[model samples]
Target: MKVVRSDWSRALLVCGKCSKKLDGGFGPKGRESLAKALRRHLGLEKGRRAAMGVIEVKCLGICPKRAVTVIDADDPHAWRLVDEGADLDAVVETLGLIRR
Candidate 1:
C-alpha cells in the first residue's frame, strides 16, 4: 500500500443531495453549492491539499428541506444543518475551520 499525506487539519462532509436540492443556493449570485461556497469563503483549495477539506458526499440521511447537512470529521457526534444562503463566515466559525 502506498502512503499518502494530506494537509487537511479537518474534514467537512457536505451532503450532495441537500446541495442539489437547493441548486446552488450559496455564493454572491446564489449560484454555488455549499461546499464550493465554503471553500471560496475560507480561501481554501480543493482536494486534500487544502488546510481544511470540504468534500461533498451522497445523502447523509438527515435531509433537511432548503438546507444542507454538514459533518465535521473532528467532531462527528454532531451534524450541522446550514440553511440556504446562510452566512459562510458563521459556518466556518461554527465548524472551527479557522486555524488558530
Candidate 2:
C-alpha cells in the first residue's frame, strides 16, 4: 500500500457566494476576500502548509444576510458567519485556528 502523508497544519472553509456578495469585505480598506484576509492574518500560505489552509468553497447552504459563512474543518457541524469589518484576531481565535 502506498501511504502518502503530509503535514496538514490547519484547515479553513470559506463560503464562495458570501465572499462574492461582499466583494472583498475583509483586509485593508475591506478590499480583500475572507480567505485572503484570514490567510494574511494567520500568516499562512495559499495551500495546506506554512500555518494552515484557507480554501474558498461553494455555498455552505446557510447564506447569511450580510456575512460570510465560515467552517472550520475540525468542526463542521457549527458554521460561523463573520460580519464585515469584524476583528480578524477575534475571528481567528474563535475559529480555534490561532491563539490569543
Query: Model 1: per-residue lDDT, tens digit, 25-83?
Result: 99999889999999888888998788888999999999898999999998999999999
What lDDT is obtained when candidate 2 is compared to the true structure?
A: 0.82
lDDT of 1 at 69: 97
Please give the RMSD to the true structure for each candidate, in Å.
1.5, 2.1
1-100: candidate 2 lDDT, tens digit per residue: 8966545566778998898998889888997999888878876777543557788999988989779998888987888999976899889778877641
TM-score of each: 0.93, 0.86
Top lDDT hit: 1
Candidate 1: which stretches are off by over 4 Å?
none
Query: Model 1 clash pairs?
Result: none
Among all windows of 10 consecutive residues in model 1, the one with the lowest summed lDDT is 91-100
Clashes within 3 Å, all models in order: 0, 0
Clashing pairs in 2: none
